[model samples]
Target: MTKYRLFTPGPVEIPERVLAAMAKTDVHHRTKEFMQIFSSTAEKFRQLVDSEHSPLFLACTGTGALEAALINSAQEGELCLYVSAGKFGERWGKIARRAGIEGVPIEANWGDSPALSKVRETCAAHPEAKVFCIQHCETSTGVLHPIEEIIPMVREECPSALIIVDSISSITTSSLSQRKLGIDILICAAQKALQLPPGLTILGLSNRAAERIQEGSPHSLYFDLKHELKNQAEGSSSWTPAIAHILGLGEVCQMIEEEGLDHMIERHNRLSKLCRFGLTQLGCTPVAEEYPANSLTPATPPEGIDAEVLRKKLQNTFHVLIAGGQDHWSGKYFRVGHMGSFSEADMRMFLGVLYDALSEMEAKLPEKAEFETSLCSFV
Candidate 1:
């Protein structure tokens, strides 16, 4: 297969070491050796979110983890509140509604952050809400919510509410501490900032969340948090595990630990800023005006250029695969992923190929397209 460097929001580039780990000899999930691997991987995974080490690992996408979090945290006829700022944020309400829970949407413009006053108002109105859902970084718009501020405010307003943070695309790309922020449930996956192929969903929980699951009905066997906690605490999954993904996750965690979490966050932030700078130099407009996510950046093509056309051109002409928009913004903007395995050198490569593609398109060029290409700060 031809190797096309991918810049999609999730499933970012995989490191060679992680790939090697996944390709190594497979182990039986029921064996003591596999249990040690599972238990060790779970510990490392929780540290990524700065949470206590006892997170649940499920062989599913971020959506499935979100579902598991919602169903297991809240019961039927319970009140659930969520922010509807982008594609993933909208999922919270949809999931709640599907679960027969009363879901309230705290609406916001797609690329804008949710208003703090509005969120506080929602908390006041729905004081009985079982769980309040919000995405740390909405991948579709690349908008990073002020969770550090929002979480504290929500905690103060709705003391009884269980706050659920979907950090799927934001974990390693951005900085967050689940315990410090008082988050009840934190969900992430192997694909995004973990630098691994999709399959594993890691959910970090607090003691309160575990108690809720113990007293409440999860409604499903596979996603039952109570059962998973009891079994996984003993180094076993309730069902079949994704052996390769677990192994890859262990390698990724080790890599991040060695690199230092603070340094990794700085690297992703540098790359994300550099990507936006390069895009702006090419006469493009970044989608997120405020609090943009470090994981990826969404931008509109230079004036008069179709986003889809540019995305395909980048893929076909340059062998660089970027992503187009979803839902109402489809064909309106394109996104570039710079999280996980992407490094300073990769960001430079992205700038070069993007410049080449735009030059071939003969798109109206910026009068003075000046952006930093210096790696001095990066090193």
Candidate 2:
């Protein structure tokens, strides 16, 4: 099998040590050995999010955590406000509606951040909204929502609202602190910047959110936050946990600690800047110019050129996997993920592959000599 480097978002390249950690003999979940690992891993997660309350680990994806947040916080008769700037952001409302909760939409065009004043206006208009859902980074458009500014505005209008954040792709790559940001619930998955495989969702919940979960009954047996919390307190999962992923996660956390969270975040920012610069040289305009995410960069190809076609060419010929746009932006743009374990050399290698692939396609690109010279500064 051909070894392809992943430049697509989610499931980014895993560190060798983390991959090796997963190969350790699996222990029974009920055993003290597993509990020790679980406890340590939980503390690492809290430190990553800067949360005082221990996070709830779910044996599912980020979307599962999002649903749990809604099911535990929003009641049937109460209003749930949703501010969506991209596909994943809109998913909050979709999940809310599926859970039989009323969602008040505060929609913005993809790649555009919703104005804080407008969001404040929406909050004021929907004072009854008890739950507010936002995304720290919209993976689909590479748009980083201004969570810090928006949170204060929302709190001023609805002081008691449960602010739920979907930071699946942003957690380690960007600056997101659940406690410092006053975020009630923050959702993350192992696959993104955590440098682990899928199947494990890390959820950071505030004390207030925990109280709400304790007060309410869960709508889902599988995603029962209260039951999971009880199991977590006992240093286990409600169901059989993904042992390999958790073990790998512990190693990833150790790597993060050794490297320092601030350094990891800086690396992501550098990679994102390099990606945007290289894409621009190749005649692609970044989708989110104003507030692009450090996790990834979505670039739109020049008109009349299909981004999906270019993505396929790069994958087939260069064995580089860059993702195409989703929903309405499908075929119109491509995305390059710079999160998790991607070194400066690795980034340059992907850019070189991209340059070669675009050259072969006869795409309108900047002079190869100049482009490479510019890329070297970041590398």
Candidate 3:
């Protein structure tokens, strides 16, 4: 049998215990035992993001959660503003349009964060926008959009607009305070930094956002936030939920608590620095160099080396599964995920394997540095 380690931005390597937890006997979603686990998991998720309210669980992937956030709160044909710095950010606007909302996009170049001034100006221009959407981390480019900075600016410029954030890849890998950031709706997924599978999507709705959802008419039954909230109050979902994933979420939450959020964030930052330094030493230019994210590092190979080919060689030969770029950058770059249950030793092993693969491909490689200066900068 072949063994592989995932370095993709999503569906990250799950811990053995979490995998075992998901294998537990299935229980009815309405049963007392299931309800207890569901309630506890919801609370842990809230604490994970430092939120005032417990987030709701959706029996779908992150994309469905994003759609739910849009269709539930923003009405069709209403002005909805979106910040698009990369592929995921751009998808927010596309999702809005699909839901029949009028989407106004604010775009930044690939590998760049939108300027605060631009966002402020956009808010001023679209004062009637119902929702302002953005991503905490742009996974495709490894850009960590400064939600702390952008949130305050959005609130001041558009006081009435609901602020929705997609933190699918960043929630657990980075530090996020939903209440402090004044974010009205936060989207999360179990397949990313949460170290779980792809069947569950978690969402945190502010009091204001909840009120807004009630006021809107989505005309949809399955994604009605108001209806789901009612079901949640009774410790169930409007539809049959992912029972096994919920149990796995509980185990993952316990792991996060044992590690402590501060330590986990710090570890992610360290890994990011090491990954960037290592990639640079391998003659690859990392995207989002100025605002690198802890979740993953996207790198472009030097001219003449096919990024997709390198990724395949790493996977097929070394059993290391890193992700390739998406959308326009496809075949142009690759991303190495260092989030969730990864360690420095794992990184070293990955770098070694990558170095060997690059050598075999006859790719030009740079001399390795001691990484001492990079280590100092992380401090």
Model 3 weakest 10-residue run by lDDT? 367-376
Which candidate has the highest TM-score of all? 2
How many clashes (backbone N, Cα, C below 3 Å) per candidate? 0, 0, 0
lDDT of each: 0.87, 0.87, 0.86
Work out the TM-score per prediction. Answer: 0.96, 0.97, 0.95
lDDT for predicted candidate 3 compared with the true structure: 0.86
Cα displacement (Å) at residue 145, model 1: 0.4
Query: What lDDT tens digits, residue by residue, belong to model 2 across residues 114-157?
Result: 88889999999987778999989999999999899999888889
Error (Å) of candidate 1 at residue 146 is 0.4
Of 1 and 3, the candidate ranking higher by lDDT: 1
- Which residue pairs clash within candidate 2? none
